[model samples]
Target: MFKDTNQEDYGSTRVEKDSIGEKKIAADSYYGINSIRARENFNISRENVHPELIRSIAVIKQAAAATNYELGLLEEGKKDAILEACSEIINSNVAEELKLDAFQGGAGTSTNMLVNEIAANRALEILGHKKGDYHIIHPNDDLNKGQSTNDVYPTALRIAVLKLLVPLTESVSKLQSALQAKEKEFSSIIKLGRTQLQDAVPITLGQEFSAYAEAVNRDRWRLYKITDRLKKINLGGTAVGTGLNTSHSYIFKIAKQLRNFSGLSLSHSENMIDITQNMDIFVEVSGLLKAAAVNLNKIASDLRLLASGPAGGIGEIRLPAVQAGSSIMPGKVNPVICEMINQLSIEVICCDQAITMAARDGQLELNAFGPLIASKILKSLEMMKNGIDKFVDKCIKGIEVNQDRCQQILDNSLAVITSLVPYIGYDQASILAREVRESDKTLRELIVEKNIFSKSELEEILKIENMTSPGRKK
Candidate 1:
């Protein structure tokens, strides 16, 4: 049964019905009955489907319009109207109006229909017709012709993910470059390296930062590789990946049009059936995201620990005091940026777990959790990108090493005895380290006073360059 309610307060009204029931929509609403039902049924997460995904869906719709028009399957006027409407969505913020839930059910069928209804109603308007006039320009018959949610949804999901990764990769690369610059700038500043939270040996602050840069470099490389994986699409594999209702000729044409429209290296998957049934690619992507998150967490934790105390903790480096550390402790500063990134990484890790489980939960021909997987992966990518940008600007680029503290700790610690084990035997070096620690004497003080080696020899052996690198001592 269809029920019509007065929509005067909302705007001019339109009545639309689907198989399940009917409802009233705002007169100018670009979405129709199916989208309205989705919004009502999946009020789980208030968040909308990602804008990038919505844009990708528009691109797919526009590409389909062009392909169908070229094949003479659709008239010129309908194709032009569909293209114009999809362009409105691609170029404008039209998706904000759809408001389909991010955590919707039905393996993203609701999302696919949301895009279809918007495109159809908007195309109707473009053709100077009213919304819900499906006979003239139907959502399924015209806008989503030759496609299924199974094929279209995942294809759009891959495109949106690929697009989002561009900015993410750039953000990570910027962070890596900043860290590399810090490495070069701090190259001459010596500090004590630690293992298992115990002082181990002498190293330059530059080396520590260089390790971080290298870790990020690996993450950047991984992002590029996974983006290539996302390019293998399933656009032509209608309904269970068998090209059931779609003509054979239009299959590759749709892929071509999509590639041209989206400017991606998109190709139809070799085995569309396998792609339709499995979501392993997303699992691989989630794993990469998890790895990057782990690196960010480790680096942030290191920064927080190193910046822990101006008077109590390691205090090897000073992070920018962007905000007050505490309300009660006067003059207290916190590593808030690092802590924020640390927490963001934990969230990303949890998102990876969600994605992994969603990917694994697919039934015979489709996964009912595609929307959840897509939403979580995209959210993780966006969160990581934003977190990294802030971390670089607010923390990494503003970090300043406590040079005197580094040198003082380096000179006083018995860990510098590691450098001496090469010249002196390990047994002698161990004895000297124990004596230096028990007597509370600096390594240089004890060495010089005991005449362990000449001042020139000590200077050469203890040089940071020699200790940090594998080369003969000067």
Candidate 2:
């Protein structure tokens, strides 16, 4: 036989080679080796799992492990090991260090792998060993034990929505507050109310601001309603909807654990099969987001229109100078911030369509496109949050009413057609309105030309308060 040349010398010992002529590795050399296979296997990337969703998944895993430990489903050593691992991951130093791409397949399998590797390493550290030793807590058998991607992914999605709902509600509330303040400040001011873009009647600026506030209030309530549904989680319905391989005790234990960890008043869903197969809940939430986007878009449009121009536009409101509006036009400050918000709102509306399509694409037992749903929903949430903050700080809070301009428009307005009612009577007032429109004459000039009332009488009668107050002048 020829002398074998595949063997390698390490110090004084000869290390034997494998069939492929590769040297055998020590146990430490193969740390976290399983994650490589997981990473490669689930490589279908239509969309990336968002960071917010990842944090949500980590939270759910921590909650489940804590609950199982508390309920005695796990022994003391294993419970401590698991909790220690979860705590380390939760308070990890390497969270910011993770630079992997977010678009792994299988509804965030790469994310799952990342979480598992981090948690496993943390668990090993707690057990007085080096990281990536799968003995104390294997990523699958221990860290992700008693759970499946089906349950975990959906649970994480819901929890992410729940967490986001708080900030969203706060932002809406702040907008409402700003509107209320504007209403009070503009209470005495009157402006022409337009119907079909034509001057109709005189209305207080306060009334207009109040309407904006009320619209946001309605959107806030809509968000609250959808967020209530997010409280239901499918943590125990591992793999499929049946909870087959999981013990009944384990299901309840995990739910209870999650409740304590998240402090969200979470509970197990009643129909696990329906929850697994249907993404209707996500659609409902996205619909609410679309509703919010519509309201915000409308508000932003109104802001732009109301702040239209210093010379040619409505010029009824003035926005603070946040930045230069144009590069070529000197002293040109545009409503660019509100425009940005409007564009963001449009994108949010489109994301809602993506959510609707993803929900409808679900097949019999599994919705194979969950990763897209998670991605779209999270994007909607973050964009809405950012838009709300910018609109508030850059536009709403800095808004100043152009009092002189408002009064100029109001004085020239033919909206005073109602003022002639008490003096010229309804029929004569109607004629005067028609005549004013036909001749394009100011309401005050018409009242004076027809001598409908004495000048002093007209002055007292045409006061803005007389028009806006619910009570008629005696």
Give me the candidate number with maximum lDDT: 1
lDDT against the true structure, each candidate: 0.87, 0.74
What shift in Å separates residue 424 of candidate 1 from its native position after superposition? 3.4
Separately for all candidates shown, the number of backbone clashes (residues 3 or more apart, or on different chains) is: 0, 1
RMSD of 2: 6.8
Q: Best candidate per TM-score, number?
A: 1
> Poorest 10 consecutive residues of model 2 by lDDT?
1-10
TM-score of 2: 0.85
Judge candidate 1 against the unseen true structure and give its global Cα lDDT, from 0 to 1.
0.87
* lDDT (10s digit) by residue, model 1, range 1-474: 012222455667778877877788887667688877777788887788998888899899999999999999999999999888888888877665557789888888888888888888878887889878889999999988999999988999899889889999999999999999999999998889999999887788999999999999999999998887889988889889999888767888998999899999999988898888888898898899899999999999999998878888889899998988789999998889999999999999999999999988899999889999988988998999999999999999999989988878776677667878777889998888788768877788789998989898888887766777777663
